[model samples]
Target: MVPITRTVPAPSSVRTARAPRRVTRPAIPGVVLAVIGLGAMAVVSLWWRDTPVIHGFGAMLTGAGQVLGLLSGYGFVVLVALMARLPPLERGIGADRLARWHAMGGRYVISLVTGHVLAITWGYAVTAHESVTSEAVTLLTSYPDVLMATVAWFLLLGIAAFSARAARRRLAYETWYYAHLYTYLAIALAFSHQFADGASFAGNLAARVAWSSLYALIGGLIAWYRLVTPLLMFARHRFTVAGVRPEAPGIVSVYITGRDLDALGAEPGQFFRWRFLARSLAWQSHPYSLSAMPRPDMMRITVKARGDHSGSLSSLRPGTRVIAEGPYGAFTPALSGRRVLLVAGGVGITPIRAMFAALPRRMSEGITLIYRASNPRDIVFRQELDAIAADRGAVVHYVVGSRARLGYDPLSALYLRAMVPGLHRYEAYVCGPAGMTRAVVAALRASGLRRRRIHHETFDF
Candidate 1:
């Protein structure tokens, strides 16, 4: 790889020319969906007025229970819908944003369900003039679906406990992911009781049909996107491993070949959740970004051994079948400005490498890549990156060294502006570990780039 050594002469200190601000609408639809969910729960509460109420503590408790139950049911549907992998919502709202919403919403739904259980049990005890324990036993025995729902409640509670940050840190991604499959069963068992035993739902035919429809629609979406779509693509493409070659220590590139590869509609700078159907790896899947421009019948992904699953990607046998889940993500060339700067850290260089291959070029050089690694020996794809830079005259800067405290960092505001002639006009794409990403983003902002001009591909689960 050719090292960057030439420096643009700095006659004076940096002069900042800010890019004009551009407003974004990525979150508008997501916000509207959230508002509608809250409002729908509010409307569900109105159904309670149609029933007779005792004018005492029992009545208040009963009403609270009904409202909480309503909120949880609504939340369950929305939570599943958000993760159903609906292309429009995922592309518009962003996969990272949707994942955050799903996780946060899960916490609230669990709380609401807990409140519903306690309030309803206490309210029923008061209404029946019985001890809380006996009333709970009676209700559980009397309701047709309550027993299943109780078990479902525990399952949801367990999932919530497993999802805690501390718990997640101890588990492998495969374990954490398989544990999430129980969520579908929990949702089914928990929702069954709403129509069968719900006081507010007893006489409301319209509400029953509406609730049923919501669940059915969400179920259909999940079935299509999560199961059916990928199976169809796998059958059609028949992707198989072609070769595996080492790029650097602990890093390897996997090449895959398939039929009519163009039909996948894969754009550069996108990724797939890949499942290699070989011994011990038949069911587990992990996301990896395309590391090279897509060829009509083949594609390539570079993987660094980061975990048990990732470490196994190097020894895949030739002809092992592959199942892929996407061309999903908005990190393509369409998001670039007239001038573009790409910042990559460690294995984060995967998508940026593909983008560099495909991003539109200006007559004058328009692409700048700043790759950060611990040292020169750790820089993956050095030869290919150099080839692209030399062929296209794109600027390449390798920031390599141990993490050291310094006021004069190469990625600091002044240095970034000095490297790129029109830094303010450049759209910056950053991908790195969380800490490094934050630092680079701050430097880009200080270099006079607007918020809308900075794009980062977020792969955090």
Candidate 2:
């Protein structure tokens, strides 16, 4: 494709001035942390109230187990809340950050559950003058809800094992995702056991009421954001595929036409978790960034053939029904500086391309885009980017070559400083493969940009 380099006047919308939206980064995270801390305190208070005396080793072990179990139950609630896809948390803390927190928290919670089981079993064994194995068997067979809790524990362990980094590599995305859905079932099975057997909850009406309320709140959030909102969007907008246009060898842009799209409140750099109502495609939803600015009746998303779901999008028929979960993410130009820099790698250019067109150019020093691709053929949206650059009086640099061919990294700190004079004054946005994103972020920091000035989101879960 021939590159369009001739300068043309920018559209009136592009030329118009709009003040950037200010977001206080620490405010939401601080509130979330404070709430979690409050929950922890409440869990400990239950144990304090119930445990008035502990005179023996067995009693001490059992008391510790009780506290651990209560905290673990509370942790599960927090874990679900993090992944509930609430708009405030998603936009404030970011989806990638929330996923990282959930993964880390899962590990800790699993460890707590294991500790709770061991301590409780050992304590019971000592108190009854019985073998540990005998005590465990009795607990499972005779206790009111111990059997179900044991099953839940095993299910949780299985999920954690599959979620490990090594196991994730061997598993398909769909397989791993579906396996995680069982977590809700496990939590449900464990709930009755917590109430029936937990020392902290036994005869403690206030504790039981508070614990139940926490679970109810998280469940409501998930139902509204993850379920009801999408159904509402489908009913209101009625999104459907309009066409599929191949961009490069393996990338295609899917056009979606919808009614009252502007009411969806989709911004330039946000993405949607789209579930296409087609054979083999309706079961899974994948997040795709908007590849262009949304029109009143249409939007576009560019997909690269990475796996089964993405590979099938190019063959999607026109008029295919779609259910989109969001216009989510906080990667927009809202918090950017007057002098802005966008760096995109391979298929990561989708959101960057949209931001390039929509970012107001008036009262700005300059806007620069650095697109990195393995080869010329790997570059997507070349012609459109060149046209936008020409029209907006922005700079577009296509850094196309393999690392071996180039002999050195073009996005290194020294090179970045040379390419964009006064780089310290610019706010940078980066999206790419994990390695490339990390490298570019390091380069930006080394080039004197502060951490807050560099914004990024990775698709790596």
Candidate 3:
């Protein structure tokens, strides 16, 4: 357990830059298959309009089945992940990966619904031999199942619409979470429509098997992710608040120690959205990185009291029961090989601190830290940072924002620019406020750093 150490160079200069584009297309094989399958079905339904009504109905049913099957699988995973129900062995995917899946699944589900709408319109056109819109309205109004499907379609649409960053930015995580919870109800409606009226499963034994198999798979996955995993956790570690101390003004650090944390199988630089039973903080959980390396015996999370729920965290008793909903991010230091550049702002220092502490003291890899805070008092782990640097020659630079004579420009871009002389040759780690991380990332890329070389932890965004 020897610590890594190396001589670090002084940072070069600072630059101000805009936030980089954070949007990425999440990879989802199931969703991709559904999109392709639905598109093919749409074509078949449209082309068979003049054929027998049974033929067109059959095509639409097949497409609907494929789309529903795919969406159900991915959606089930998301539900389990959000609920902290996934088994320890299977819950390795972090928030970044989850968000990517969510985005891809969302797009695919919309595409499937769009295909469903188009195919149904064609079916109506062939059956009524008139305006399909009129027939669609008729179907929607006449059948309860059809009505439910339409309602579910609208709900899915709403969820997808608000899932966008622009809309999500305006809502609190709790509101966004609750609003999105309707996804289950929407899917239930979809299930009813599929079983009750879907031609694929109506009278066919194979289709019945297919539907039954889908239910079993989705059901088993749900049980594994939600009920079984949580039950096992409650039986084992059963977390209770060990202590809550203010590490800095308006910043409280909650200490939690439990059995079986070694079995929790988390790494340094990851975070959890913590829940406390206190009435003031119970409604929503807040994401906080383990401020120090987890040592099986105890875990520490440093949280800044920025919002109503977070602000009241200090009021909780030491013995309060707590539920941690994560270990849900992927900013671990394992991916890098060259020297590491760790950057933080305000409360953003937690994950970086963990990585710093976790590294061996004499391992010869270079490390540099650029920590920005409002003032001297706002810094968390100030003594720890000093001690680590003193022991290992880890270069530590502090940017006191409010005290700067240049009138407190956001130091994120500046820090990145200052470090850029050799940064392109090393790995970059950033965790902090979204604005700061964005600015730094943009600055690095604008200066021609490769995107792969820049690594970051998941934050509130």
Best by TM-score: 2
Q: Residue-wise lDDT of candidate 2 within 1-461, one digit each (tens)?
A: 42212221222134331223454456677898898999899789878988879978888888888889988999999999999999988877778888999999999999999999999999988888899999999999999999999999999999999999999999999999999999999999999999999877889898789889989999999999999999999999999988787778888888888898767776667889999999999999999998865566777899999999999998898889999998888777755367889999999998888888776656146789999999898898877788778777888889999989999999899989988899899989898999999999999999899998998877778
Write one digit per residue (lDDT tens) for candidate 3, span 101-190.
657757765776767666666655565675777877887887558888788888988988888888988887778889887987887777
- How many residue-pair clashes does candidate 3 contain? 16
Segments in model 3 whose C-alpha atoms lie over 4 Å from true places:
1-93, 141-144, 160-167, 202-204, 280-283, 402-421, 446-448
TM-score (C-alpha, index-matched) for candidate 2: 0.94
Q: What is the C-alpha local distance difference test score of candidate 2?
A: 0.85
Write down the lDDT of every candidate, Cα atoms only. 0.78, 0.85, 0.64
Candidate order (lDDT): 2, 1, 3
Ranking by TM-score: 2, 1, 3
Q: Estimate the TM-score of every prediction.
A: 0.88, 0.94, 0.77
The lDDT leader among the candidates is: 2
Better of 1 and 3 by lDDT: 1
Tell me each candidate's RMSD, in Å, in order.
7.2, 3.4, 8.5
